[model samples]
Target: MSTLTERIDIQVKSRHELDEQLEAAVRELQEAALHVRARGILITRRLPGRYTAELSDHVPFGMTRELLR
Candidate 1:
């Protein structure tokens, strides 16, 4: 039997350019206010609820409270 491993590669132009790239990425997320998670080069998205509210709407207050744990 053989096992397969998955890997992702991320390429950037320069270290100093990282801030600019992050800013652009944040702007994109804020414009839609969706959850964004990145691992290596893989990016995942979590959509918001149907109700129009602030980012807090997506997460329950109790969940946020427990997150302090």
Candidate 2:
């Protein structure tokens, strides 16, 4: 399976703009045609609820967090 983690912040004046942005994003992803070792997809969205920079570490299954340090 493949996992996609995305965080998008919006401060748009109209709903139509949001819809258009979403459509463009979807099309971009589809055009990329990403390669995956597994057959399924998993997506996670994290909205921090406040304006702040975020960080992420992509560690796959069977890996320990400490190993990264």
Candidate 3:
């Protein structure tokens, strides 16, 4: 079990773009196929044209954290 706390912010014009980038980021992070058990993607938008995407720090193994709407 491992924990990933680092966050990456994405700036896009629309939610669709954000979603696309967010999934890409997640895929990029897990691209190595290191068996990161707690692989989770958290998406948050508290500012305009900016979205936060990060691997959830407390996600249970074999499950992903729910997106923060």
lDDT of each: 0.30, 0.32, 0.62
Compute each candidate's TM-score over C-alphas.
0.32, 0.35, 0.56
Each prediction's total of clashing residue pairs, residues at least 3 apart in sequence or on different chains, is: 0, 0, 0
Selected candidate, larger TM-score, 1 vs 3: 3
Off by over 4 Å in 3: 1-5, 32-39, 66-69
lDDT of 2 by residue, 1-66 (tens): 755423334334466765565455444333332333222211222332212111123433222121
Q: Over the stretch 1-69, how does candidate 1's per-residue lDDT look in tens digits?
A: 632222212235565554455445434434443233221222222222111112234443222111110
Residue pairs in steric clash, candidate 2?
Answer: none
- What would the per-residue lDDT of candidate 3 be over residues 1-69, giving only the tens digit for each residue? 765435778899988987798788667545422356555556677577777766665654334354545
Top TM-score model: 3
Worst 10-residue lDDT window, candidate 3: 60-69
Choose the strongest candidate by lDDT. 3
Q: Give the TM-score of candidate 3.
A: 0.56
Cα misplacement distance, residue 56 of candidate 3 (Å): 2.5
